[model samples]
Target: MAEFKIVLSDRETGRSYKIDATGPAAGALIGRRIGEEIEGGVLGFAGYRIRITGASDRTGIPARRDLPGPARRRLLLSRGVGFHPVREGERRRKSVRGNEISADIVQVNAVVTQRGSKPLDEYFNRPEAAAE
Candidate 1:
């Protein structure tokens, strides 16, 4: 089964929570892409909604939204997700994963788009069986 370390960022609190997803929960994330919205119920957030922001593969390559598929590619870039230019008009070829989520992905980054009745602080503070 595919497993992923999910980091959920709360815009209001400016705080982030870490959760592990595996089995069915992990299965729900497959084929999802950056900038896509997902139901919170899939990740056990119930009423809350999550938006995919970014992801990293097992090899630590960051996924780019502009890319089309789930394969890694070396692209010449001016400035973007995986590459940061120091000088003016500087560009370099860098390896970045495609937007699509796959089993090779190790980490998933998201932001809460909708608020549930309960605050995330109270939710995360409660100890529960997190995916291992």
Candidate 2:
């Protein structure tokens, strides 16, 4: 899979996530920019309405203005116009505007749940994981 970095931010709260795309979703997410949106996961399952504070590459995912159908709808709902982050477990039950995420937006859910992980900036800067 293609590897790239992601720097996400909250326009309202000023929080951010500095992520390394290690899966198939890498190229599809690069260069999204702040206030821009993308969709992931499933409709009923866990999902996100992210504003791209920063993106690393620009080859895979195209701009929202170029998308069509449900893909566009998902983007427009989660990322378009006035978008924000959803809560951890509320999922489809709660709207993005009403829910709150844990800590800073830069701390991705996966990375945070790992046995022992540091802050995104520190983890990226450091060489190894520390003890929990």
lDDT digits (tens) for residues 1-132 of candidate 1: 999999999999798999999999999999999999999989888899999999999889999999989999999989989999999999999999999999999999999999988778777765442431
Model 2 — TM-score against the truth?
Answer: 0.31
Regions of model 2 farther than 4 Å from truth: 30-36, 42-45, 53-132
TM-scores of the models, in the order given: 0.92, 0.31
C-alpha lDDT score of every prediction, in listed order: 0.92, 0.33
List the candidate 1 regions with Cα displacement exceeding 4 Å. 126-132
Give the alpha carbon lDDT tens digit for every residue of 1-132 in model 2. Answer: 445545544343344555665555554443333344555331111234443432211322322323322121223343342344465433222112211211112212211111112243343454452442
Clashing pairs in 2: 16-106, 17-106, 33-52, 34-52
- The TM-score leader among the candidates is 1
Could you tell me which residue pairs clash in candidate 1?
A: none
Q: Where does the lowest 10-residue lDDT sum fall in candidate 2?
A: 94-103
The deviation in Å at residue 124 for candidate 2 is 13
